[model samples]
Target: MAAASGTRPEHMAPAEVFYDGTEAKKYTSSSRIIDVQAQMAHRCIELMALPPGHRCFILDIGCGSGLSGEALSSAGHAWVGTDISADMLTVGLARGTPGDTLLSDMGQGLPFRTGSFDGAISVSAVQWLCYATQKSHQPYRRIRAFFASLYRCLKRGARAALQIYPENAAHLEMLSAAAAKAGFRGGLVVDFPNSTKAKKYYLCLVAGSGERDDSAAAATSAAGAAAGAAADSSSSSASDGDLKHSDAAMEATDGMGSAMTSSGLVVAMGRRSSSDFEKRRRSRAQDRVGAHAPARKEWVLRKKEQRRAKGLPTRSDSKYTGRRRPDRIT
Candidate 1:
């Protein structure tokens, strides 16, 4: 749809130009659009994998008219929504959604502190970040900045599900690459992957610095180190195996580029869960399982406890606990 009487949709309008005044009113009052937004937002929240009855702080990006926020609010989630259109936020205020709303361009990056939000959901909003309405607006940089900022602000182990409408394979890859580079672990999960009309592309993301990811990384690193050690120890097939392992890791990234075929865009009507993510994750973890360090001997812990009971100092309960022994170590 055109932003103004003669505006072309290809040259997308700024959020204010397209969603303010009459446009905002029309959108807020439209039953069809509202329903669609509600459904998509609900799906995005589901993809976040929050436990049932769990109330969390959520971020609603491109929260036009607060339709998406309404769903989150109804679910008893506290949210802070942002949009580039003040008119939309005004409508949201009128509706009395249970959350704060801000007029801000997401392309410039979110303003929340690191680890501020438990999760994030953007319904029909991320795609807008792909369009540059101003001369200074570079889509790649903007998208990267937004995802990078988002990655930092989410709590460890938190997920974000972005429901985006990419114009083409190139656009989709562009967004996915940026997310991956920003250290997200999940991928483009297409709900109803076989149905063109019903298919939804959800960029499901888990913060890469989370404990799960750290363990995965440590596993992969251990695998590589073990492979190196084997290569040095044996002068037979081990060397070839190490070369194959390195080659496979390098080859894995080849498909991350803009190599998706046009036919690949035609999603059929079939909903599939993100099982592949789990599969690959487990595979990586298994690859290094054999190299896992042996558990610490029980005697080490026993001795530490013995020393503590005798009023001697031992390492704090945890690395960060820093609970020093009382005065004389007792």
Candidate 2:
């Protein structure tokens, strides 16, 4: 909830210390938090691309107060959730959440066995691993250990869609690198990237060789395409009021051979081709050489004329005054 208002609770305290009994109850009872968590959970499942009509045993990492677990159950999947906060798990038990809850620190690594779950989903988690709350906690090592354990617990070809609120580009890069190092294939899938409030980052990862059913792969691709379409639509809508301005700005940037977009999205607009780069390089080289080269004959003559008009003695102009002599025949 603090993250919603631009305040990161992870910065204030560790997950276990922040989400105490009072905070857990408040988070569970908030309608907005419940709805947002549910939406993100559904999106995570979509990104997972689980087979249709088949029940899956999923792992819900950092399933705070079982809100996201409730979503997994709604999709007809059985999920076991793990959280670092005991009070949160207690509150989830009191609420009669469908999934079983375990009290464990994810940064220490998941407790599940190898290939135990069909897929995994995490909502508003993972970012905590990038921060060190204890003296023994090394962000990179903890991230590496957590991802390694998660990768082992997942069946080959299974996916884990973890929705994280990265603090910055560096944190995002660290998490991604750690996941890749753990042997998971795939990359980040960002939805509604143009909107500050609606933008979400999902690290969609595949376990092992990624030899999954074709239908599942198609589903994943379709989901990614749909997210792209949504982002485009949102961007277009946001710039509708300033369409002409946006177009003009884009044109100016393009004219300058810049690869930046007018709306500041990651989408590149005026990427120069190889020939364009070559031409620009040649032009710059010519300018650098010309800056230090001797003045042309016409320039020397003009300067002499200016000196004469200033009443200073100047060289007389003749046919050869600004002409170079021919080379003698060898």
Q: Write the per-residue lDDT of candidate 2 for residues 60-125, one digit (tens) a residue.
A: 999878999999999999999999999999999999999999999988889989999999999888
> Model 1, range 21-45, lDDT digits (tens) per residue?
7778887887766776887787677
Which candidate gets the maximum TM-score versus the true structure?
2
lDDT of 2: 0.76
Error of 1 at 282 (Å): 28
Off by over 4 Å in 2: 1-5, 213-218, 231-330
Cα lDDT, all candidates: 0.67, 0.76
**Candidate 1 Cα outliers beyond 4 Å, as residue runs:** 1-10, 209-330
The C-alpha RMSD of each candidate to the native structure, in angstroms, is 21.0, 12.0
Clashes of 2: 0
* TM-score for all models, in order of appearance: 0.63, 0.70
